[model samples]
Target: REMLVAEIEKRLPAWEKKTHLKCNGWQTKIMQNKWGSCNPAGKLWFNLHLAHTPIRCLDYVILHELLHLKVRHHNKDYIALLDKYMPFWQEVRKELNDFVLMPMK
Candidate 1:
């Protein structure tokens, strides 16, 4: 849990610096389906299972949710943001999708 939080914290500054978007706050929890989610208030939530995945997966999910603060939907603007920030996001997303979410201890 702490590892996931630390990972988010570590990547946030650079993302904020590049995009000028601030993440109000975030929480890690045992989500059954989604890897991450962003609220309208700019707060983010990451699936606790992410910590067991690759760092790239966590990074991808972080950027995915962060971009939601700007685009709100998986529209052109959101796709553009993902392309702009992480050019290889689709590949990383594919990798993430391959992992079956296991119940965390």
Candidate 2:
């Protein structure tokens, strides 16, 4: 939990500075369905499980959410934006997606 918060604090601003996109706010919560989510309004919610993933995955999520501030959905424009920024986003996304956020019983 603390690690996740620290990573977000460290990464968010750096990415925001690079992308020139600011989010309204953000928080981490226990979520099973998604790694991260964002609204067109610029609020972001990240899954706490991210702490267990690789640091690069966390960076990917941060940039992914920030991009939402520009493009609302995962459409062509959004893909173009992500591709422009993180050329290896797809690999990181796949890694994060393959991670089990929770152990099923």
Candidate 3:
């Protein structure tokens, strides 16, 4: 968890500086249908399953939610912002979606 937070902090500086956005905190937990979620209040959470995926995938999820802090919906403006920050975000998103995690049972 500490490592993940560190990575988030590292990746966040430029975005935060550029957009003046801030994230209060984050955590990880088992999620059935989503890799992450963010609220208007700036709190973020990641699916515990992300621990097993590639670091870039985790970064992708974090960035996705962080962008939500600025853009409330997946509209054109939101997508343009994502493209500006993470140019290949669509490819990264596809990789994340294509990844298969075994069922907990």
Candidate 4:
């Protein structure tokens, strides 16, 4: 998860150089009912299933959370920010969140 976050962060600047958000850290674990979560304090958590998702989907998630630094809630401003950075974010989000993967037994 840390590595994935790092990779995403590394690509963030190039995505929208105007946005000044930064990522403090991220964690990925076997969360039963969440795709990801971000807090006002800047912590990020992702479901373990994301490890297998396409890179674009991962980028959408990272950008979504990073936007929280500027907009705390999922309001118009937040959605607009995401739309600006990731035009297809909503679609990618639906695809990524709805994805279900079985863990190794």
Global Cα RMSD, each model? 1.0, 1.9, 2.3, 2.8
lDDT of all predictions: 0.89, 0.91, 0.80, 0.73
Model 4, range 1-105, lDDT digits (tens) per residue?
677666655765654355777656666667766667887778777666676788788777767767877888899999888878778887898888778866634
Question: Please, what are the lDDT tens digits per residue for candidate 2 over residues 1-105?
Answer: 897899899999999999999999999988878889997677999999888899999999999999989888899999998999999999999998999879433
Off by over 4 Å in 4: 1-9, 12-18, 101-105
Candidate 3 deviant stretches above 4 angstroms: 1-6, 9-19, 101-105
lDDT of 2 at 50: 89
TM-score of each: 0.94, 0.94, 0.81, 0.76
The best-first sequence of candidates by lDDT reads 2, 1, 3, 4
Candidate 2 overall lDDT versus native: 0.91
**Clash number for every model?**
0, 0, 0, 0
Q: Which pairs of residues clash in candidate 1, taking residues 3 or more apart in a chain or in different chains?
A: none
Query: In lDDT terms, which candidate is top?
Result: 2
Error of 1 at 70 (Å): 0.7
Q: For model 1, what is the alpha-carbon lDDT of residue 80?
A: 90
Candidate 3 per-residue C-alpha lDDT over 29-99 given as tens digits, one digit per residue, 9 for 90 to 100: 77888999997678888877776778888877877888899888999999998888789999999999997
Runs in model 1 deviating more than 4 A are: none
